[model samples]
Target: MGYKQRISLLMLIDSLIVLVSVVFSYWLLSPTLYLAPAVVGISSVTLFIGHHIFAHVFKLYKRVWQYASINELLSITTAVSLSIMTLAFVQLLSFQTVYSRTLLVTWMLHILLIGASRFSWRLYRDTKMQSDKNKKRTLIIGAGNGGTLVARQLLNSGTSELYPVAFVDDDVTKRDLTIMGIQVIGNTKDIEKVVVEKNIEHIIIAIPSLIKCELNDIFSKCAVTKVKTQIMPSVEDIMSGRVSVNAIRDVQVEDLLGRAPVKLDNKKIADYLTGKTILVTGAGGSIGSEVCRQVAKFHPKAIILLGHGENSIYSIDMELSTITDGIVIKPEIADVQDKQRIQTLIEKYEPDVVYHAAAHKHVPLMEKNPHEAVKNNVIGTKNVAEAADEAGVTAFVMVSTDKAVNPTSVMGATKRIAEMLVQHMDMISETKFVAVRFGNVLGSRGSVIPLFKKQIEAGGPITVTHPDMTRYFMTIPEASRLVIQAGAIAKGGETFVLDMGEPVKIVDLAKNLIRLSGLTEEDIPIQFTGMRPGEKLFEELLSENEVHSEQIYPMIYRGKTPPVNVNVLYDLIEKSHHLDKGELKDLVLDIAHFKTKYLTQLSLVE
Candidate 1:
């Protein structure tokens, strides 16, 4: 039946019960003397009207019958009290004391009976709903606040597909106890057994503050179970007051790395990018595209995407256009090495900030064609920095690598030269030129994560360069965010390096990837392919001679390198430009030794 019809029926039944109780009380109080039928009927009608009016005003009918709580009980009490008061006032005014004051006491008992009856029906209906045949048996991994909140939401929501069967918590004291009607089964160690016993279809990890390492361990344990698993978003996400079911996304590659999230100063970052015209060179590349995405959040006045690849550039442009509503994003096809084209574009756009991410980054490829590395990584950077200076850009940031700290690969040497070029240019230019350097970005194109994933998916024999090889890793988005923040804090001639957490051994990384994919070491074999040309066993973010200090941002560090004579450096680069490939290699080799002691240490590590 409809709610209105049901409420009307309840009201009628309650009124009849109240009338009967009142008549009985009158009989007991004064059996020898009886009131006129007319007076009794009038009094009954008056009481019913008073009760109905007070209940309606109190919104008693609006309460959800099945989910009634203490709040609803309070409302019922107020409605009943007002009804009794109205009836007493009416009796006193009419001088109807002949009816006896004992009827008023009976009316109070009637209110309690009616209210209890209504609440009892609601409780019975809810219990039946919970025990319905179609309810999904689910397990909650934590019995903390977040878990309790999730359980409450599920219970209150009648249309939800999930039912809380039990909870799994680490606290021994909580075991075998019940919370919000759901029992605590055991700790996470017992998840498999609990899932099997309870026929659980889903498991929810409700600990938002869990570290990645703990999450990885939990995920490993849960991966074997048939139940689908989900996690609560991080505490920061919840604290921001943006919590929702949709925010709880599937576990990603980043989660397996066990790296902590990067922290930033929003005020400083916003102040740097807001309303400024920003340009990202190589905007279509993995790191470059992420930088574009991060910068767009700051509501830049305009963002110019400078890249040579049309398809990559077009894809990033479309992606950014869809995401950025108020910002203007202009994609231009131009090679950074072409000084004339880069100069023209910069002069036209007059970008307040420029992120020079255009370079040949692949180590083996650069090693095979060393001159090309010089052309793109070294010369291209010089061209862009010069153009930014000529156009009077406020800041120019060069996206560099940890390899640049020491020279090993042609790619590394070229990048180091790029940093030197920028440092030298900063001495002459009014624009603030800075280099932001870091190690590998996880899940980027051609990165170890994707390579490992492909190998695992292809079945057996995941290849690693060497068993001893290790490299620092960070999420693409985190690295990109740090780059933008670094730009905001850049003064002339400073190198901002990211504190990429502990370096991960490549061999161990492969094994972990295999395990994360639900494969055993015996099932998925790891093969060590000899190291690639120009590849090093380890990478460093700073040279031994370089002085470093903490930045305002926790993950970012500023390094002070010895000043180079710009005039002499330019002359040397010009000389190398005229040399043959063989001579150039020799010149690069000579320059490599003079660079830093980190290079020799890297060689030893290799």
Candidate 2:
């Protein structure tokens, strides 16, 4: 039955218990039949009616049995007390009533007994729900307020089905104590023994306020146990009073590497994109699609999806169409390198802002085909920026990468050149040109996440570039949303670098992914495949030459870089028309290194 029906049944049982108590008290108070049957019956009926009325008013039946708290018990007690007082007044008014103080005292005792019985039943049911024979035996890693909160939620939720057997706290005083009926096994040093002796299936980290080093240490302990792990969200999230059992999610690969969540300012992002028409180039690609999704939420006037790939464009168009019914989402299949086509689209749509996300981003692939990367990323960016400027667009944003900062790879070099082009264009154009640069997006195609997941699912060795190789990572949607926000906040010629939480070691990431998939490192072995050509062991967001300052948005920082000569850059780009592949590559490499080489080359070539 539903909760309300069950609660009604319990109330009926309580009334019967009260009636029995009253009879027993009356028998003891008077040996003879002094009280009239009609008066006694009337009093009993009045008490039942009063309880029903007060219970309804207090919403007692509405409380979920599993989630019942002390507050609910207090409400129940208040309702019963009020009902008893009303019964007492009724007995005084009736002349035929044998008003015995003993009977009244019995009624109050009965109320306490009945209330406690119902509460105990609810607690028993909640505890029983976690008694699945095959349920995971979990060990919580903290004993603070946050940990206790998590424990209470888990015991009450009746979902998730995780059974908490013990808590591991570093505090010596709490080492032998019990919380919520579970024993505190020991400090961090006893993690291995606790896991082995208790047959722990999982380790739940309940320390939301833990620092990076402490978290890393806990993760190390968890790794030795070879148990699956989960983590509670931040303390602020819990303190904001929105924390729930569902907030505890599987520990991500990023957490083990000591990465914290990035803080973002919502107001700054909302101000720039809301109520504006935005055009995103490469709208079907990983980054572009994410940008489109994020932009749609800001209630933009319209979003034009412009990309060369018809299938990719159509897929995102269909997805956005389902979500953004009221907002205008127009998809156009056109390459950014086609200046005439790009100019035509921009003029026709008259977008307020443009995000040029189209690019060849893979390092090894771009290295083999530098000409393609240059043509698409470098030249394509130029076409889009120039067209947006000509069409009187307010802002032009280019999606860039960490590889662009002191790059050793062709992809990185091309992106750097693209940044240079935008900086140069911004000087002479009315349009505000800006670039947003960051490191790899997790789960995007060509990213390591999906690749490792696929390999592990296939029951084979997970491949890593090297044991020490590391890279900065951000989720695709998070990265894209920040990109949209950054675009809106751009004034002119600012390269906004997003704050990627931390650099994750590739080997460690693979291992965590294995455990999260319900497997061990032994089952899914990691193979160290040496680094690829032009790929770096680590990635940097900004070079030593660049200095940064906080922008209006917390997540975004503006880089201080030398400006490019507009006239000279324009002339050199125009001259690039006559150069062959080899000459173009040489020209791009030379131009990318100098602060004003493009300007000098343009003047000389022109």
Candidate 3:
């Protein structure tokens, strides 16, 4: 019906309900055939006027009864009770002839009659909208608040093809309970059996707070069942009101990381970044781009994105432009290794803080081509640090890796050299030059997580270097936040190390990725190909020689870097371009003094 018509129809229904209640109450109070018609008329008119006034004030007629909830029912009760109470006051003062019990009866009858009338449509609509046939039977994994909300939203939505059939919760107390009419069937371990017995076609993991290991277990069970699985948004997203439980999305490998989302000191981070012109070298890469995105949240005056890849730089620049306002985004296409180019950019922008993240970081590739590793990681870092020093930047933070400690790969050695250069410069320069070291980032361009996902998608053997190999991992945002936090706490020359939780075994990581992809290890076999060239069995955060001291900021520490041989490092960097591949590798190791430690550990054969 039309808007005005619908409103009028509701009003008529309410008026009739009020009149019936009045007549019913009058008959109940005076059954001796001495009924007063004038009394009934006056009571009916008073009730109708009072109720309509309150109803209009409450905007009762504006609600769609086909989707009525608890709030709607409460509204009806309040309107009816208020109207009857006003009528009762009037009867006591002006109409003492009528019984007081008559007003009480009318109040109860009015609420029941009016509430039923409003909800009848909702009951009918729900019945008409739902059907068991031809709909996909869906199971919700959590029976807690998130899962309850998902079930409630789905039951009321009436638009989806998926129907919630049951809930699977691990809590023993919640197992026998029902949420929104869906019974909690069993724990995650019984998922496969439940899916088979219930003919479930889809499953939604509604536990936003599920950790990685728990998620991996649930996903493994779901993978065995071969049912399509989806997940709710992260707890952070939900708490921030960015999304709701109904925002079900495809499960990503990142979700399998299972680490609680990093919580940073926003005010401290913002204070350090606000109104500052910051420079991010290698801003197109995963970590660099994330740093830019997080830094943009602080309302910086300008963010200079310097990277060798023009396309990556353009993508980040455009993305930030849409989300941030009044902040200048300067995407410069230049290599960090080009000292003159970097010098020119720093001179032009005069950035207050510089984050140098450009480096060739893939272990296998860097081991094969140590020249590029040195040229990019070592030389590029020297160029950026010197430029930042020359510009008198307040704080300069260079991104380093865990591999840089007790180094094995050429990539690690080059990063170590870069750290030395920054530390050496910190001693004399006015700028607070520091290096932030952390372990492998989960979703970086060359990370093994992406490779495992692709292998799982391709339906074949997932490759791993060694079954026992382990590496510390953190999300790009977590790593980025720590890096920014490091800059905030940087005093010069200290190599700040991020507290990457426990190291994860590569085999287990691969297995979790397989499970997250809705496939078990048997479906996509994990093949141990043995360790590659310069690959280590485990990665360490701090070297044996480097002593660490805790900082005020949690998950961040200051490590004592070995003194840099300034003259020798400068000579090595100067001769680096002319040296052969073998000579360059030797030169890089000599500069970092890592030649002896890694000499016996180099396993070139893959």
RMSD, each candidate, Å?
Answer: 5.1, 4.3, 4.5
Q: Write the per-residue lDDT of candidate 1 for residues 246-359, one digit (tens) a residue.
A: 244556657767777777678888998999999999999999999998898889999999999999999999999998988998999999889999999999999999998888
Taken over the whole model, the C-alpha lDDT of each candidate is 0.80, 0.79, 0.84
Clashing pairs in 2: 572-602
Better model by TM-score: candidate 2 vs candidate 3: 3
Weakest 10 consecutive residues of candidate 1 by summed lDDT: 597-606
Candidate 1: what lDDT?
Answer: 0.80
For candidate 1, the clash count comes to: 0
Alpha carbon lDDT of residue 518, candidate 2?
Answer: 72
Model 3 per-residue lDDT at 500: 67
Using lDDT as the measure, the top candidate is 3
TM-score of each predicted structure versus truth: 0.82, 0.84, 0.88
Clashing residue pairs in candidate 1 (N, C-alpha, C atoms within 3 angstroms): none
**C-alpha lDDT (0 to 100) for residue 168 of candidate 3:** 93
Cα lDDT tens digits, model 3, 374-440, are 8898878988888899998999999999988877778988898788788888888999999999888
